[model samples]
Target: MGTVRRRLAGRALSGSLALLGVLLVVPSLYSPTREMAVADREHGSLLSHQWEWSWGRVRVAGLEGVELRDQWNPFGLAVLVVLLVSGLAGVCVWLARRVTWGHVLGLVTVGLLTGRVLTTVAERLGRSLGEVDQGAAGLTVRTEMTQAGSLETVAACVLVVALVLMGVAAARSTGRSTLPAKLPGTPAAGTAAAGPPAGRAGPAGLRPVGEHLTTAPVSFDDAGAGGGGGGADTPATAGKPGRTP
Candidate 1:
């Protein structure tokens, strides 16, 4: 019963993590911390800018439309891959009701994804605060990550913890399932210490020969007396009938 409960809990956690990851992927996770206004020296106009990070793309918007759009950094790409792989592994584990390689894969995926997101956020925030960009006509602009990115980072951390717990639960369930069960009325460990030693006598009432032996009394004396009496009678009859001899 305990094992069954653990398995059910593991499945529930895996499914929940997988669903959360899928939902997070759908929404825009990254948004600019602050709007940038750059002065156009030639036109004397102020241009607005915004930035967003997606799966493998970094999008920058200008006053009119998209200004600079490109692929994400290698670290960001790796994070995206981890996120995708972990989500898939979680789903598979829940559906198959087995751990196997999925546990290790999910653990690695969550760790990498969470670590990358945290590092990236920290680096971006530090750079945005410490450095300044000097554009045309000495126009200075700085940007930092917003709450959306931070929230996503926090979610990634939570997902990693959830995956770890899921792995633990699955491992426990697997162990319980694989262990041998004791039969009814079977003695537990060290309980047979009082039993007989090997090659010793068994229980009472059982014999190797299987049956008891018996003997009958003899009558040698009676046989001898009857023989002597018969001999004497024969001799007396011969004496009485010897007159003709």
Candidate 2:
């Protein structure tokens, strides 16, 4: 019963982690990790851009006067790889009805690293944009991350927390399954009561029994009857009877 319960709990945790992974992927697809704005000082026109990262693609959208450029960075690619692998692992775990600490750790690490990398990339992109020369055209560029409560950030946090919780649950289940079960009426170690008082007889003249013995006691009356029969047939008794006859 305990083993069954533990397996069920592990499966539940795996399912939860999978759900979290899917949720995390959704926000990554639609939410912009960073926003960029380019302005022509002379023309007074501002161009807004949004960068979104997903499993297989990177999206850049220009909301105003400039054309969006397609670009990829090493860091962005690495983050994408982690996201894809973690998402797939989660799905497999959910389907297989199993979960391990390694899976949980992978999910957690991916989540945390994704957030960190997003921040770092955003900062680097912002810096690079600020340094670009407009080539005699009065142009300025600025970049900023999306709001704190952006869906991507929220999803990443949720995924990380879910993985941590799953790991903890799996660990607890494993610990419980490995422990030995205590049987009913069994004394705990170091506290077993001393056996029935020494030399005290049990039911029907039986010796006091411990945990293992179950034999019935010998009959004292049967032994006495056998002894009397043997005495009646002794040599002296036979001679006396013959002489009287």
Query: TM-scores, in order shown?
Result: 0.55, 0.48
* Candidate 1 clashes between residue pairs 3 or more apart in a chain or in different chains: none
How would you encode candidate 1's per-residue C-alpha lDDT over 35-122 as one tens digit per residue?
3445565565556565556444455556676476544566755656667666666566664656567655555665555565556556
Query: Model 2, range 1-245, lDDT digits (tens) per residue?
Result: 98678666765665566565445555454455555566777876775554544332344555454556666556656665566566656546544544545445444654554465356444545555566656477876765556422555555555666556666665665676687799778898766765465567555755446745543443334543366666444332112233321
Let me know the TM-score candidate 2 reaches against the reference structure.
0.48
Count of clashes in candidate 2: 0
Model 2's lDDT to the true fold? Answer: 0.55
User: What is the lDDT, from 0 to 100, of the residue 94 in candidate 2?
Assistant: 46
lDDT of 2 at 14: 55
Count clashing residue pairs per candidate.
Answer: 0, 0
As a TM-score, model 1 comes out at: 0.55
